[model samples]
Target: MSVLDFDNLTKRYGRTTALRELTLSIPEGSVYGLLGPNGSGKTTTLGLALGVLQPSGGTVRWFGAPATAATRRRVGALLETPNFYPYLSARQNLQIAADVKQTDARSLEAALETVGLAQRQREPVSGFSLGMKQRLAIGAALLGRPEVLVLDEPTNGLDPQGIADVRALVQRLAAEGRTVIMASHLLDEIEKVCTHVAVLHQGQLRSAGPVAASLATADRVVLGLAPGTAADVLRAALSSLPFVQDVRPETDGRVSCALAIGHSPASLNQALFAQGLALAHLEMRHRRLEDQFLELIKN
Candidate 1:
């Protein structure tokens, strides 16, 4: 069942519209990615969904019904950098947040462990790295053990190690059976961590669905043959297959091709093997999120 639904949701600021007729559903137990470039309505969509901002038109629904304050409580979100006292320890800060949110004080211990900060519970917030700070913010969100987490750029301003840390943590959270809806401009991070993705552009949804299926729906595939084989030999084989379309050559002596809408890497491999050819290297590449985002807005 869908845990969240946006029914023709629209949000506008006077003459400028931030969202346009967004109709999307987020099922339970999904790690959903809300993606777009800056100023592409990603933040606005999250705000509307969580009731932090009112929609200009249409309804926001949670758990198959219209959203309410009680429904909002079932979701935790971090839209921006969390404010923590520089001198206060992690535990101390969360304690204050718990009281402010009126969540159970007993959640303090579980929240700390959920974000993997229990070991450093006594450390001052000032000493933590940017990634640690982000994790602490997520810990604060996790205080109520909400059924869903709405995180806007959870890995912003972090080093590579920090990015990896947060990715693993998100996966862990999903494995625990909670839904996560993350809004991020970092396409690579979203590709790595999210199971489902929705791409937005100019206040409109360009695409939405399972990440792999959406990417594979229409993608570029690169096939490299070993030194003993000529490029023409493989090209001829691929060209004969119905699933391969727009077969072309690459500068690196690889064959670049597009798969038919319903085809996949496995289908290509199976078809090639039937013709007695073993693939030395096969890589599938899709238009980058940046390129796709531009195309969405441009068209």
Candidate 2:
């Protein structure tokens, strides 16, 4: 089931259209990433879906219905910077958040432990690292055990260790059977943690699907012939195969081509061998997510 759906959802600010006709459905139990560079409407989309900002056009639905107060309660969000009293302990901050949410403090212990702040719950927020504070903020969002989490650039300004902490925390949250919708400009972060991704550029949807499938669209199978074999012979053989496409020569004296749908590297190798051409090297060059992201937004 989709935890959230956006049907041609759009947001405009005066003369500028921040988000345009963004239609997407976030599947339940999946870690969905909104991938784009700055000013690409990632935040605008999140704001519209969370009801923090009214859409200029279209609809935002949560759990197949309009976002009501009850439905909003089922979603936990860390939209921007984490706000906490500098002098308050982590536990105290969560207490304040609970009060704001009108939720009981009964779940504080579990939330603290889940974010790995139980041991340091008593430490003053001023003494905690940025990553710790972020986790504490996430703990606050966990006050009522929401079924979905929405995080925007959860690792935006952290050191390597802090980024790692938040990444691990996100993974842990998804493992507990909750849907996590994260927005980030970092291609590596999205590629590493997201099960599915939607690429946005200039407020328009570029591509959306399972991460592997999206990247697979650009994958190529590289073929290298024996040292004595003429390169033209290899190219000629590839040109004759109906399943091969985009045949190109690599600078390293090797040939690369994309295989058609339902075809595999093993099948390609078998087909080449049947044509009396033995391959000295054959490997699948899986395209990086960064390459795919750049290509999507380049235009």
Per lDDT, the best of the predicted structures is 2
Off by over 4 Å in 1: 84-93, 113-133, 223-240, 249-255, 261-298
Q: Would you give me the overall lDDT of model 2?
A: 0.90
Clashes of each: 0, 0
lDDT measured at residue 229 in model 1 versus the true structure, 0 to 100 = 87
Over 4 Å off, model 2 = 85-89, 119-129
Pairs clashing within candidate 2:
none
* lDDT, each prediction: 0.87, 0.90
TM-score of each: 0.79, 0.92
Residue-by-residue lDDT tens digits, candidate 1, 1-299? 99999999999999999999999999999999998889989999988887889899988899998888778778888886766998999999999888766799899999888778899999999999877888899889988788898899998767777677778878988999999999998888888889999999889999899987766655789998887788898999999998789999996678989888878888999999999989989998876655655565676
